[model samples]
Target: MPSEVVVEKQKLKNPPLDLRYLGDRALRQPAKRVAKVDQELRLLAKEMLQTMYTADGIGLAAPQVAVQKQVIVIDCEPDNPANPPLILVNPVIKQLSSQLCVMQEGCLSIPGVYLDVVRPQVAEISYKDENGRPRTLKANELLARCIQHEIDHLNGVLFVDRVENKIALNAELSKHGFSAKAVKPIA
Candidate 1:
């Protein structure tokens, strides 16, 4: 059996998983590391990838789907069918670059809102593949940022929390009909 399953680029008859929004309690809770990579877990990853593609998102965390598991699916190039998505289980950040870059980031949970968030330029992460095989990846630029953002979701952290410019943050949130209070800023 293949270690990973690539969800075909086809819309399912049913709607995607209901994503937990910023103010939702489920989004605040930290996700638990997956204990076993069974058939069920693999199925969840497949479904997550499908949900992400359907929502036009590059990355998604298990908590976003109210799963409470440390699973994340990322696909930087969704338009290219040849490029497969990644399924990370029990991911751990091993190294981070000292350099920081600021980029506009958006989340499916907080739709219609975008904010500039600063993050490390590079990251090395160790994780398990969909087959539960150990794997490590060194990511840079957009991929690094995406992985960090999704990892934050596993830790109950939102990209809004990393937004330093409160004025811009509040404006975007307000414009998107989201409450500014929903953001829990980090020091």
Candidate 2:
């Protein structure tokens, strides 16, 4: 006779984030609801920070968590203890330049897949900080790219959508042993 077996399921410390699909239904238009930087958003920010840290990610957008609001959390200064993680609400990329740079990028949504993507090297963004005070920031380098990437997600654009060359994207996907069968166009 086999010994009696018992198993217990452990709850996830941080629930997995939801990645929105690109479509009319998924396209989150500019929200007029005006998200308040209240306790819920704060808690969400905290969870996102925890999730990002767990995943070793530099930034995360609200859309990645199934929140259809313009929110983002970033901790690009990972080495700096003095600089805490930032939470932006109703973020808007107010200004962008023509200059572009390409960087190999990966997404937490589509795990284990990386591809080169071209984005503006710098951008001026205006958003309400965690305190709900309007703030303007001029970001460059990796920070700029991250902000652009997250903001794009709020507007229903994926990094794959910004791939300058599909062949290159597909090649990279193939190299990683992932299929590019479900590639969606930026709607």
Candidate 3:
């Protein structure tokens, strides 16, 4: 089982956050790195976790909530209350495996749009924990993919932008009433 937060789904309260959707200008803006991880940042992480749970998402980034800050909250095992969640501030991917895996990825911002995106099979990241302590995490499988996805948000990147299938990507975006031109594909 991947790392997760021990959150009671029933007791979770949805935070009042306006989630930026696909084609939203705010979603395209890069998130600024958080220099200080204080109580307020911790509180934001809690709220982000709550919002992610409410939206049935595994991971979320500050930019998704319209806050241009480099903060991310992720829980790979949301169904398990005993599992702990991860909160990363100013997360930087220090290493990525050469091996790649294609996984169907979805985003809270681009709801209802899922596409297969190729990403590194493993990732090692260094970041500040919720308590402002330096921490490092090495993850594989779904957890690894989720981390990469959220980190992309911090850099103003989206999963759709990583999709290689142009026809499928455009079709999916169009089906969801989103403009394909908004996607800034990574070469």
Candidate 4:
């Protein structure tokens, strides 16, 4: 079946949406669950995909664009036109592997700040497709990490907030011109 919303996977000079940065209050606010799947929501997903591709990001949450809706778009293979992007609405993480892995993570919202963050190696999530159909996904490795990271945005969390190395985190944030105070650490 074709994707509910489709756009050429290419970077445009001006994307439809503007991204909120690390310290922006909009990015720090939790997103609201989507009440219904309709043309407007689908359009948002399409615009988000375009913005994500333009920003060269593998995943993006609605909150990152200050939309304040529980929506996410992911495409690990932005270089592959054959691979369809994943648009998730009101996504919920149902399971996470006990096994943890540390991987380098970066975000468009945080710009140049990249750091190693530990997360479950595998994850299972349930969410609605752009067409309002319910679906479940079991993913591992980078896909799992992407899912977790994007979902965290729906909850007003950023990848930097999960960085365990305080020294590295502080240094990177400072170098990137973002305040360490903006990061709300998780546990």
TM-score of each: 0.96, 0.79, 0.93, 0.98
Say which candidate scores most in TM-score. 4
lDDT tens digits, residues 1-187, model 4? 5677988999999999999998899988899999999999999999999999999999999999999999999999999999999999999999999999999999999999889999999999999999999999999999999999999999999998899999999999999999999999999
Misplaced by over 4 Å in model 2 are 1-33, 174-181
Segments in model 4 whose C-alpha atoms lie over 4 Å from true places? none
Model 1 clash pairs are none
Off by over 4 Å in 3: 1-7, 10-14
lDDT of each: 0.92, 0.70, 0.88, 0.95
* C-alpha lDDT of candidate 1 relative to the true structure: 0.92
Residue pairs with backbone atoms closer than 3 Å in model 4 (clashes)? none
Assess the local accuracy of residue 154 in candidate 4 as a C-alpha lDDT between 0 and 100. 94
98 Cα displacement, candidate 4 (Å): 0.5
Ten consecutive residues with minimal summed lDDT in candidate 4?
A: 1-10
Cα lDDT tens digits for candidate 3, 1-187: 3223334554245455768898888888899989887868877887788788888899999999999999999889888877788889999999999999999999999889999999999999999888878889999999999999999999899999899999999999999998998899999
Return model 1's CA RMSD, one decimal: 1.2
For model 2, residues 36-140, the per-residue Cα lDDT tens digits are: 777676666766666666666778887776777777888786556556776788888899889998888877665666778878899999998766778899999
Query: Which is superior by TM-score, 1 or 3?
Result: 1
